[model samples]
Target: MLDFLNDILWGKVLIALLITIGIGFTVASRFVQFRYFGRMFRILGASQAFKHDKHGHLSSFQALLLSVAGRVGGGNIAGVAVAITLGGPGAIFWMWVVGMMGMATSFLECTLAQTYKQAEPDGTYRGGPAHYISRGLGARWNWLAGLYSVLLLVTFGFCFTALQSYAVATSVGDAFGVPVLYSGIALAVIVGMIIFGGVKRIAKVTEVLVPVMAVGYLLVAFVVLGMNLERIPDVITLIVKSAFGLEPMVGGGIGAAILMGVKRGLFSNEAGLGSAPNVAAVAYVPHPANQGIVQAFSVFIDTLVICSATAFIILLSSVYEPGSGVSVEGVALTQSALADHVGDWGRSFVSIALLLFGFSTVLYNYYLGENSLNFFSTDNTRLLNGFRVLIIALVCWGATTDLSTVFGFADVTMGLLALVNLIALLFLFKPGLRIMRDFDRQIAEGIEQPVFDVSRFDDMNLDAAAWEIEPEDLARIRQREAAAVAQGK
Candidate 1:
């Protein structure tokens, strides 16, 4: 039944919806992701100025890293391997295509998240598809919001966490000869320590660890690519040819490549899957579009950069032969590719990298669950605590479970969550555009830093505590606007 559902959802429905809607969003937003690409870095650099010392609020940069932590996990390593194995080298091309389109999708959804984020009783900001659906649409949609929240809880909290844990366990077992049970137990303990500390702790840890892990993995991938520099063009040609069935390969033809590519690509970057916006809503930014732009860049980093690196490393190595009838070995394929380049130590390096990447993702996924729990009832302490324990146990169990089962369940739930979120985004399309126009208007008027004008959205019933400017901040914004106008900016 799971396989049947996956075939229907991923093979047909999601492929069409993801591509069509992603292209629609890109065109509708006037290519917001591309136009604001450079500004994303500028806004990220300026995050320090908008830092909130508020207990539950995250700085924009921190939120970016947290989202990155969620994105750059097993999917980059094992998932890429699976795509190549099942869809051939051509699958990598489709992955790139979906990733690029996903940036626009991510921007719209995240901006909506910020626009409708609620100020929680504990001074924390909360939002996602659920919040926006309920608040932006109407109380009648509360049921839809609840469905999204539950799907999020199951997908991120249990399925994804277990899948990541499984990746870590398998890699460690393959690389270091560690027992899966021991590794699982240790991972659970380590994860428990950090998750118990809550979102603030997760933010702090990811801000530091995400950069280090991503850079370290990329550096290794670069070294492997450098070793195979002469074959770079050929590899690129192979990917393009295979993607369109011009090249015969192990994963059948163009159809398989498209399926695997879109599936794994979404798994890696999760742009329109409605996960990143949960973390995006926690950020403090002068304009919601500012964070939206920043979040789009993360999709670029996850797939275009990191996932591409993994693809290159595999393609360049003799361990991965195009059209070769080799069974998919998930993370082990990636580890073997590195070993072929750098010997025994390469395996250990990949194992350690997966542990870090997967661990950080575990933290990010847990926070998504917590954020969703906030949607239901923020005061359910006992239930929240029990769920934490449950998550930890799932992580341990994931280490020893069948990879296919874990992935199948995750794919089904992820598809459902994304389907709902995309439908909701379509419904809120006009409001989303209005917000974008407001931001563009500020930018057109020569505002160096566009602050969101809450007044323009008064009828929207957005959370005042989240968007309302304080007296001093409002004064500063007006002064800046005046200065810009005087200088004819």
Candidate 2:
């Protein structure tokens, strides 16, 4: 049954769905991502007051960490390998396009998640596709929420969880000669210790690990690119050719390449997957949109930055043959590609990084499933404990199973849940538009600096006579709007 389902899951069914949604979102947003491309990173990095609702649990920065943890997980390693293997070099180009467009979709989805977020009995908060879907589309369609929860558990809880374990074990065993079983056991124990502390702890760990892993990994890629710098121009040309249906022969021209790149890129970044929204809810802020923008930056970090690093290393190595040499699979292929040019020891560096990447993902994924389960029931202690146990057990199952099915299963689940999420966004687009305008207006009117501050919101008079925001935020928004009206940005 798993095998049969896995086939349909990864085959055209999910692929078609992903492509359609990516294209649909890009069109609906009027290609706003391109217009906002310059400001996206700049706005996210600007110093602003974060709205921290008195009831909020996590900080805006913490929410980004959680979302980053989920996105930067197993997919960054094995998912990329799978894309290259099946889609050929052209696929990388498509992935980049997807990442670019997906950024807009991510901004929309996360904005809605924040709009519908809930305070919890435990002082923390919970929200995601499930919450926003039901809230936006109306309670009549709550079943969609239930369906999305099940898919999330299967995809995030089992498939990716196990994939992470497997990646870490496989990479560790290859690099350190550690036994796979030992690695798995250690992974389980370490994961339990971290998750026991819950969302805040998970966020803390990811904040530290993500940057180190990302920067460290990028530095290595830069070194390789420097060595093969001469081929940089040719590699870029090839990427463009494959992207535009211009592939020499055995491959499809630029069009197929573009699609392939988008496919893998979306899989890697998961902008519309509705996964990041779960983490975005935990932030300590009054205006939920603060976390939305922060989470949007995560898509940029995962796909635009880290995934780009992997692509550069692989292509720059001039070692990524259509039919490869070592039959390298998963993280091993990635490590081997790095080692080929950098030296044998480079594998160890990647192996360690993969371990942090995978382990952090498991902790954050637990939060995704946990939030869903919370939505399903309130005082069911048994159910909550059962969820934790089930997630852990699935982690073990994923570690030992044949990964082909796991990958397929995850793809299917991700697509299915995202289907319901997309529908929810359609209904909620009105509120989302209103809130974004309000946010931008807040900046334009000089109401507040773009920062998180819950106390400021407690008694806020929306109808205040004078605009109270910081001068800079409002000035920038007006400037951008004026630019848009002038140059049609």
Candidate 3:
């Protein structure tokens, strides 16, 4: 039943929806993802406008790292291996296509998240598909928001945590002969320590870990690519030719290539699935589009860089056997590829890397659910605390148990979440476009720093408190209002 549902939802319905939305968003936004490609770094380098509230809110860079932490996970390693194994080298080409298109979808969804975010009593911001569905679409659509929140909680909070834990346990067990039970317990404890400290601690930890893990992994990939320099051209040609079914080695045909590419690509980067926006909304940026651009860049980094690294490593190595039905499982395939290239130490290196990737992903999944819980009932501390305990338990269980069924269920829920979010995004498309236009206009007028004016969005259902100006800026604005009042009198 789980496989049937997954086949129907992810294989048929969600794949088309993902591609259509990606293309639609890309066209609608006038390719804002491409236009602001370089500006992403500029916005990321800018100092936080609300540094005083750093404990409660995240800087743009921190939020980018948070989203990246969620994205560059076990999926980048194991998931890529699965795509290549099932769909051949052509799958990598399709993955790149989806990544390119998904960047625009990411930009739109994240901009909407920022525009509709709410300010919490603790000075934190919370928003996502649910927040936008209720707030942007008005009270009548609150049910849709509730549905989205429930699906998000189930998908990320429970299922994905398990999936990530399973990857870590399996990889570590394979490499070190560690018992799954022991690894599961240790995994639970380490996750509990960071999660208990709340989003601030998660942010601090990921901000440091994301750069280190991503760069180190890429460096190793570069070395592998460098060693196989002679095969680079052949590998590139194979990927393109396989993608189009021009290569005889690809038995799955173009349809399978597209399906696996879209499925795993979406899983890896999470561009249009409404997951990243939860974290994206936590950033303190000058303009809502600032975070949007930063997040769009994240898609590039996840697929174009990190995921591509995994693909290249596998493709360049002799361990990858095209058209072989006996290929290794995801993490094992990656381990085998690296080990074949370097040595036995390469397998251990991959195990440690998987642990780090899985750890950060589990942390991210918890926060996504916690944010959903916040949306559901802000005052229900009991429920929130209970949910955290449930999450920790799920983490341990996932580590110890086989998660084939769990992953199937997760895929179905994720599909539903994306459907709900894409519908809401379509409804609220104009506001997102308007917000982007306003930001672009500011940049066009030579504003070195573009700040969002709350008054400009008076007609929209935005939370004023969430977009309130800094103290210094507020004082200056008040003086201008006073001067205008005096002049009118």
Q: Tell me the tens digit of each residue's lDDT in model 2 across 235-293.
A: 77766666665655514445445444655676678877788887775555445555556
Q: For residues 184-288, could you state the per-residue lDDT of candidate 3 as single tens digits?
A: 889998898898888899999999999999999999999999899999999999899999999766748777788889889999999888999999998876689
Candidate 1 per-residue lDDT over residues 1-489, each given as its tens digit: 999999998898888878777898889889998999998877876677556554546878999999999999999988899899989999999999999999988998999999999876666788988999999989999999999999999999988888888889988998888999899999999889988898888989998899999999999988988888899999999999999999864577999999999999998999878999999998877789888899999999999999999999889988888876664468889888888899979889989999999999999999999888989997888988998999899989999988787678888999999889988988988888888888898888767788886777888979888875546545665675577678884
Measured with C-alpha atoms, the lDDT of residue 285 in candidate 3 is: 68
lDDT-based ranking, best first?
A: 1, 3, 2
Off by over 4 Å in 2: 1-56, 248-260, 322-329, 448-489
Give me the candidate number with maximum lDDT: 1
- Error in Å for residue 390 of model 2: 3.2
Model 3 misplacement above 4 A = 48-50, 473-489
RMSD of 2: 6.0
The whole-model lDDT of each prediction reads 0.88, 0.68, 0.87
- Taking all chains together, the TM-score of candidate 2 against the true structure is 0.84
Choose 2 or 3, whichever is better by lDDT: 3
Ranked by TM-score, the better of candidates 1 and 3 is: 1
